[model samples]
Target chain A: SQTIHQWPATLVQPVGSPLSLECTVEGTSNPNLYWYRQAAGRGLQLLFYSVGIGQISSEVPQNLSASRPQDRQFILSSKKLLLSDSGFYLCVGTRFSYEQYFGPGTRLTVT
Target chain B: SQQGEEDPQALSIQEGENATMNCSYKTSINNLQWYRQNSGRGLVHLILIRSNEREKHSGRLRVTLDTSKKSSSLLITASRAADTASYFCAVTDSWGKFQFGAGTQVVVTP
Candidate 1:
């Protein structure tokens, strides 16, 4: 079983401030990691995905970026925050299976 | 663009009744999965149906898939208040990338 851990479950940041959200996976190696954002009462939008270290793919061009420094560590960063960036962020991890394990998620509120 | 689109963006049903939601997709897929998410929480995998399968059952949940139609349906039998949540359908392409639908908000009243 793979467990995904995300830090700072809730965050409130001002516009133009920087942002950093972290996700780590356990019990899996070289797994595919994904970053998603969900607006209030809406479906998820894939922001980025990483298949390996230093390899990141952006599904939608946005103010967010993703990095995979290690096999099990994935990070979401932003140089400056935008009011539209406020949403619930989720981190997912998966091996070769169609099943994806999701983290508890972080609630970001850009003020 | 999203590959899957769920019908009946919202549903309201009483307890002990059955709730059904439909999902339609645009392209070929390797598998389709259903997930449930409570308020302010992460999504939990509910069930998965492959392209070759027609129907699958898991406890009170039933899933039907039609490849020719490029659609699927999820039925929740004898629903409870605990079942009140947002249900999403995700389609996995041949490349294993998953695209999620907007979801159906099911509210089971007691």
Candidate 2:
């Protein structure tokens, strides 16, 4: 079965702290990877997407960045966390011809 | 501006009743999809309707897409308390970029 894995289900960090969240997919090859942030009581905002290794597209220019180091590995990182970055972060993998599946998601609380 | 926008920021319904939500997009799409997200959980894709399709159903869920109007609707029949969650509409463009709207929070009471 196709599955996506996200690490550090929840995180707490003070403003200005560095951040790193990882996501990996299994049972799929060359799947598109996407990063999204969801604010409380609001819809998801697309942050970044990767179509292939070393190629990334950012939807919003913010304090975060995404990298695809491997075919199945995607990472979201920030040099300094901001209070506004406190939100639920989700990793998604999509089959080129079909719908996307989500990882369990990482909840970041920047105080 | 976001590509898709869901109507009714919130909704409430009794168990066994039906729940419906609407989504409108700003541009033409290759397909539209609906997703459900439980509190503190990742989102689950519920259904997808292609631009060439009109209506599709999965169990008790029905989705209708009107490409001409750039709108879609999701209907859940016999909703249960467990169905309480946020429903989001996402659109995929020809390039496969997904854009989502603010979700509609559905509360199904027992």
Q: Residues A9-103, candidate 2, lDDT per residue (tens digit)?
A: 99999999999999999998888898999987778998999999999998898989999999999999999999999999999888864667789
Best by lDDT: 1
For model 1, residues B1-110, the per-residue Cα lDDT tens digits are 66789989999999999999999999889889999999868788899998889999999999999999999999999999999999999888776677788899999999
lDDT of 2 at B62: 98
Instruction: Go through the candidates in order and give each one's DockQ.
Output: 0.56, 0.58
Q: What RMSD value applies to candidate 1?
A: 1.6
Candidates in order, TM-scores: namely 0.93, 0.91
| Candidate 1: pairs in clash | none
Highest TM-score, which number?
1
Candidate lDDT (C-alpha), each: 0.91, 0.90
Native contacts present in each candidate (fraction): 0.39, 0.48
